[model samples]
Target: MVKYADDFKAMVVQEYLRGTIGYKVLAEKHGIKSKNQIVDWVNAYKKFGIEGLFRKRRHEVYSVQFKLDVLSFMKRTGASHAETALHFGLTNPSMIGDWKKKFLEGGAEALDYPKGRPVMSDKAKNVKKNQKPTQQDEMTCEQKLEQENELLRLEVEYLKKLRAFQMDPEGYLEKHKQRYHSNSKKNSD
Candidate 1:
């Protein structure tokens, strides 16, 4: 929405209040897109005088409690967003709508400021800084012993298999071919 100056809004609103011309004709004469904009301005002017028509110079920060209060007031009075904004001296009516949406979606917490990036814990940082690569650091004693035992078992199994293969390479080759052929036939079928 295009922001009109306070004086311009007041002038338009005053002209609108004169009751001679309709909102559509007044909007058309002033090059405003929607008649509702003029209506809103007029409503704001009535409710809040000249101050409601003025745009805020800086961004206004509303606390979570304030947002909740606004929502509660709107619900209690059955007021529209524009009416609620005018009552609260807020420049933008959409802000009340946004607050209502947030409140409905997540209750009160949604109106609070968003949680930013997560911070790393001090213990994690200290651990990372102090850690170094070393043989002992690679594995615990129990892990190292288990790994060595596994390697020895694997080596023994390999030697036994090698001896068996050497003793009967032709027999092993024949058995392997028969096994693979049957498996392949099963797969194809």
Candidate 2:
């Protein structure tokens, strides 16, 4: 959790790489929490220089092939998560662990970058670009009916819930606890 400066990290890594002192001894000398952290820094420095020692501005997106290659190399060499991450120039070793888990659970497809936003289809994009406001009636019969049905279902659910709350305000509140209730209240209860 401690954030070490880039210069400090480089210095530590250089010291470790010099072969003058062991990780445990260096960690003890520098008052570091774990010797493994020093090992990670040293490996990162060796593979990626000082850049890997600093925190990245944004998350790195890896291709499926790249992920597969990293996993393959790790397996072939019997390397640990930290070692593999260091070799790959990844700042966090946990990322390699996550990739391995995803690969094991769902194969290469699991390594694909998750789409963060919904993209408009080509037709929709053209419509928007042309500044043509399409009417709801222009939708296919099936699509119009589906949208109406969904709206009706939502309204009915809302009314039923509202009626229940009106009929039994105390009981409704008692049944549904506030998710963000104060910790002091929880402790007292």
Output the number of the lDDT-best candidate.
1
Segments in model 1 whose C-alpha atoms lie over 4 Å from true places: 114-189
lDDT of 2 by residue, 83-181 (tens): 766655567777788888986786555667563755689998887787855675388888979966765664455456556656775675455335212
Model 2 misplacement above 4 A? 1-8, 14-21, 115-189
Candidate 1 TM-score, true structure as reference: 0.52
lDDT for 69 (candidate 1): 49
Worst 10 residues of 2 by lDDT: 179-188
The lowest-lDDT stretch of 10 consecutive residues in candidate 1 is: 180-189
Error of 1 at 140 (Å): 31
Superposition error at 13 for model 1 (Å): 1.3
